[model samples]
Target: MNEFQPITVSRRSSREEREIALMQIYRQVLERVPYSYERKAMAKAERDFLSDKIGVRRFLKELGHSRVYLDSFYYSSANLKFLELCFKHFMGRAPLNRDEIRDYCDILMKQGVHHVITAILDSEEYRKVFGCFTVPYARQTKYYESPKAYLESDILNHEHVAQRGRAVPTLYWHQLGLNCEGGVCITIEGENPALQNYHPEMKEAEAPQGTRIQQELLELLHGLDAVEAQRLVASLHRKQDRA
Candidate 1:
């Protein structure tokens, strides 16, 4: 991936340039896996991105849910291990702390894997790092809090199944100094800003009326089909006149 270099696509970019962007985009998302020719699952997504009908973010969502990714990473790996891989591929890091892992694990258990994939791609951190049109790459420059993020990246971004198995997080081992030959390991922690407080399911009873409405709205729009989503959004506009 050339130090996870960025080959961004713009509306003004030439066809050949966008094509190159497509190649690198796949490399960045799928890692060292085969992202061309054999990937019939991603054919429509490929066409949309090439024609500028979809941005890199949307393309990434497709790639994240593709059967290749599910077979290679999701279904094969446990929830924690899968979360670590998603962080490396989409967000360019590992679990910052136990809470971060727990939060995603919560979402994974409650909402299913596809939502977890979309949550990472839809994060504010993701928007800040790669935005809509730019490709996501495992680059350290985007992460400055700790240099170990790169090390964690290396651990989580592998094509081989994580040696830690599906249940344990890579960060836990890194904390215990199992990932390296070190005397001690300090904590590497960050908040759960990515998933918009996806932890602790704030369903009907738990959340107050206003928060409950927001939660319900979010749920409604999340995984809906196109026509249904459009209709619901229109109804929301007609109904929710608040800021």
Candidate 2:
């Protein structure tokens, strides 16, 4: 009787390796890049490019040309803001100081946005720390001790904050029947006659529609258990009957 031996193979074909590399690049670009809009379209485009075997530098350049990038970062934002975006998207770090900002801004002004992006990706610093396979992460420095502090700093000014605030289309404040500032003045004129009485502590005109007793009962029963709620209701009913 011959003994059966198990064989183990640990190797991937060139095509398989290339596919894996492309998928990795896609993930890194998608995850690291900060596109404000058209995320789904951008992801699809990256996948398509991977299928076509487009190199990383070209992939990054293509991402930079995206509508979201063009509208938000490239065309709209200032040179300094663009440099900051490049740092966040490529190196996963905030610019340490004014000099660093100036140096990048100089590059952007001289070579252009695409060249600046390519330079960052091809930098010896980036290559040494995060190779092609590894995803770049934020390199924490002493300038901003923590993420909270970093966000609070002048680096993230109100202009940047306001730029990110997109107007929600489906959110109709007018449909809520609110005034211009989302406030409504309650008046007794069109309200139910039974609800005209004001709370004792409140100003007569500013009082709620419902009586104090009804308000108290509602507050009491708001989060009660079944037994407790029933008991409270029965007690209130008894008190009403006695009155």
Best by lDDT: 1
Predict model 1's lDDT versus the native.
Answer: 0.61
Summarize candidate 2's per-residue lDDT along 60-114 as a digit string, tens digits. Answer: 5666656655565566443444566567656666555444655665676667777
Pairs that collide, model 1: none
Candidate 1 TM-score versus the reference: 0.64
TM-score per candidate, in order?
0.64, 0.42
Q: Could you give me the TM-score of model 2 versus the true structure?
A: 0.42
lDDT of each: 0.61, 0.45
Query: In angstroms, how far off is 193's CA in candidate 2?
Result: 59
lDDT of 1 by residue, 47-76 (tens): 898888988888888888878778777876
